[model samples]
Target: MEPIIIDGTAKTPTVKFDSTTGVMEIKGRSIPENSIEFYKPMVDWLDEYAKSSKDQTVVNVQLEYFNTSSSKCILDVFKKLEAINKGGSKVLINWYYEEDDEDMLEAGEDYESIIRVPFKMIEIVE
Candidate 1:
């Protein structure tokens, strides 16, 4: 399967979904005007990847900020990964937040509580 790569913009996050390495990452801001439109492809790709994914999949999420819609879309992405995990592959989520950003840390914790996949909270020094 081909990889999914989207460049980040002022109002969107950079997305790198590598089918070869089983390493997916979304970084930067996520405040797109159309959150669903921006994230639909990613969710779709995850669905496809669920069929023959690697033994272990690693997801990295590092967001500076995101809107409410983007937050829901992000959850959708996680849900897809959860499904993949349920199917047998090991899925690990690495949630990165700046040490001083309590809000981001809380966001990661929130997602961790909602999703079944194991999550590692990584504190990044600024």
Candidate 2:
């Protein structure tokens, strides 16, 4: 599968899905007007990837600040990964947050608890 690349804008985050290694990464701020519009294709791509995916899949989520709508979209993305894990594939999520951002860390923790996939939280100093 080809990579899904979306450049970051003022209101939306950047997305990079590398199908070769099954390392999907999303970064930057997310506050899109229509959350579905920004995440629909991504969700679709993940679904397709899960069907023909490798044994190990890693999703690296590195978002600075995302709105409530984007939060829901992120959860949807995780759900897709959960489905992949249920299919006998090992899945890991690396949620990176800024060192000073407690909210982001807590958000990651929340996702970690809710998701069945193995999740690692990392604090980056920037």
lDDT of 2: 0.91
Clashes of each: 0, 0
lDDT of 1 at 11: 99
lDDT (tens digit, per residue) of candidate 2 on 14-117: 99998788888999999987798899989999988987888899888889889999989999999999999999579999999999899999999999889898
* Candidate lDDT values, in order: 0.95, 0.91
The residue pairs in collision within model 1 are: none
Q: What is the alpha-carbon lDDT of model 1 when measured against the actual structure?
A: 0.95
Runs off by more than 4 Å, candidate 2? none
Question: Per-residue lDDT tens digits of candidate 1, residues 20-44?
Answer: 9999999999998889999999999
Candidate topping lDDT: 1
Which candidate leads the pack in TM-score? 1
Weakest 10 consecutive residues of candidate 1 by summed lDDT: 80-89
